[model samples]
Target: MSIIAFSIAKIYSDSALNDENTFEETEKKFDKINNNDGIFEYKSDGFYLKQNKTREYIKWIEIESVIYFDYHILKNVNSTGIEISTSHKIYKIHNNDERSMGIEKFENELNKNINKNELYDSEVLSDGSSKTPLYIKSKI
Candidate 1:
């Protein structure tokens, strides 16, 4: 998960704008990533998984409040597969290093344009539970 987090952070850092258009641009970038070879595709309802040549999974997660750019490790699994579990939503993953590099580069740009503290913050969930804060420190 750290790799995914790092990857996401890298993407955000590369593209620093928080405007409404950012989401669309990110999606387009993700589309390019998914089309690359060596990346297997699987979908589950609204969830999608893209595995690299090593069979490790990188994900583009979309929930109600936020869109997550990350990857996860699948343990004790079988051969590579792609499955779609939902009808209303679609998800995908990209297996290309070039695409990942693009995301990383975009994140770098975002990091350069925005202040870490201003972009994200630690806060309590609606359930009244407090969560650990993630602070983005400036690399510039």
Candidate 2:
């Protein structure tokens, strides 16, 4: 059984930005336990259930602030994969199609605050590639 606690839930409510929305609803939190036989045991708030018995796709009742782990995020980015670095640790955002929009939204927020011109020189990288960093706009 693997347990992961995320700061927020990435919900896919739109398709224009690739069908995703990151909502900061903090009411439901739970753990997903997976058995060896490909059965998933979801435990949270006095709810215990099993999935993946008959079919590969399993659906559950929607909760206020719970998001499932999507593995497709890591697959579509590149062969080397997408590596996200935070202040605490490095995370490999895997490929889970549902979560793609949320991740991209978060990245956009971070990129907006970065000042590429001030941080790095105008020279290209060792691979002869130069990409400008993202700059975020402030509200105030």
Candidate 3:
């Protein structure tokens, strides 16, 4: 059973879980990482997304990739995040939209314990994609 915790209620099955709009809102709302109100201790068994607060598990196999990134345009609300893309939804976790030094910490936490060979190492995936030690698409 796949469960997504949008709140204390609103749990959906994995088969019924890909509503783009809802996921987008969930992403945008939870973009920043604040200890009092954000995701932490993220881990996977190569198949699920486990973290705090929600206690909902997103299967990783359902995810196409996790694009961890940080960018700013004219310092307009500095945005830094990991875009979790699945076959039908995108979940954004903006690590530090309010600050400048937290992106690195967010990233380090994101890649913690995951092997280097398990994710997309290059900034861009070439026309010829390289295979990861683990068959999952995660780029940093």
Candidate 4:
């Protein structure tokens, strides 16, 4: 009975968990990032991340890694996050945060801009709370 329940949950999660954003959607978000009015802003050279009221500019060459993953905040609310690691600092961007640029757009740009030293992809089931653990970490 538990196996059957797990199968059903896996199927449901596979169908419901979608994190990819269309190019059009990401392009529209590009406008916002270009406007330079948010927690995250994009530039041709790199990007700016605003944290604690201070804006820090991160150059593409300084990035060591980028990890993309999905996570759930509640039963039905699922979101994605992008974690960028530099030599001395780690920055995180959450899709659900209103103050930030859309994570999808940032991620898409990251793919185009940076060269990462190490790439890894995996699913991390935060807190062991999610039954299906739908999120996967991709090098995106």
Candidate 5:
């Protein structure tokens, strides 16, 4: 009876340990999918863009305008690109970049964070290019 009780207790303890490990692994996977993108990471406050050697962090409030354009590579092959103008600098993301498949998703997320008053879509030009003016703060 003593041996049987000890075996049952050991089995139960091992099962509990395995369950904990499984839960931890599942959580890690969820976090990876949630926070990571091809070339960006979406956060509660802002997003991070990973380039060749530098990682740029832009806050939602700093973005001034967003320009969406289609890059015509060939007669049939066209790619999408976005130019993000912020108070500090301008950043461009094209579909040709490595791990940049999340550009559209990033753009959508950005739209959700920016204020409607400040968010300006690009104006199309005669040559098919686009532009947007720098964000001017409202004087009240």
Candidate 6:
């Protein structure tokens, strides 16, 4: 167990996950959590989620899990923001109501893509366990 000097979340522009190949050319932005790619799409080949143009292609199959947490604040949150948990790291995505892009829209799209890809939503157990491909709501 050494140490990870830079393990911050990679922000996307939503376009990073348009359909799949449509976003292969999307430049992966980095630099102290710069908001880059939008939305998140899974390509048969791979997807980009980093802060570098040279190395940000991530294979879809490589993704072991995806946790969507958009419950920030009803008013404070500009539309919506979510964190995608992957095997490597967590990616941060923020969207606003501009251009008809809001939290509700993004959330629905995210779910559609997940189901289309045949992914399994993990469930976070009360014992502190975890899982999701679908979506786990509040715990009470």
* Winning candidate number (lDDT): 5
| Residues 1-140, model 4: lDDT tens digits | 99999888767765665544544456666676655445667788988888767889998777766666567667787767667777879776665667555565666676677543444446457553222211223345
Better of 1 and 4 by TM-score: 4
Q: Between which residue pairs do clashes occur in model 5? A: none
lDDT of 1 at 91: 31
lDDT of 5 by residue, 1-140 (tens): 99999888877766777664555566876665544467877788888888766889988777766667675556577666777777899887776756565665675586577655665666775656555533434545
**Cα lDDT tens digits for candidate 1, 1-140:** 99999889867965887653476678887776544433233333221233344443322232212222222323432221112222244333232333333333323333443344554443444534332222233335
State in Å the error of residue 92, model 5. 0.6
lDDT of 3: 0.47
RMSD of each: 17.8, 18.8, 18.3, 11.8, 12.2, 19.0
The TM-score values for the models, in the order shown, are 0.22, 0.25, 0.37, 0.53, 0.55, 0.35
Best-to-worst ranking by lDDT:
5, 4, 3, 6, 1, 2
TM for candidate 3 is 0.37
Where model 2 places Cα greater than 4 Å from the true spot, the runs are 1-81, 118-140
Winner of 3 and 6 under TM-score:
3
Reference-based lDDT, each prediction: 0.37, 0.28, 0.47, 0.64, 0.68, 0.43
| Candidate with better lDDT, 5 vs 6 | 5
TM-score leader: 5
Point out where model 6 deviates above 4 Å: 1-43, 50-55, 74-79, 97-140
Misplaced by over 4 Å in model 1 are: 1-70, 76-97, 118-140
What overall lDDT, based on C-alpha atoms, would model 1 receive against the true structure?
0.37
Give residue 51's error in model 1 in angstroms: 16
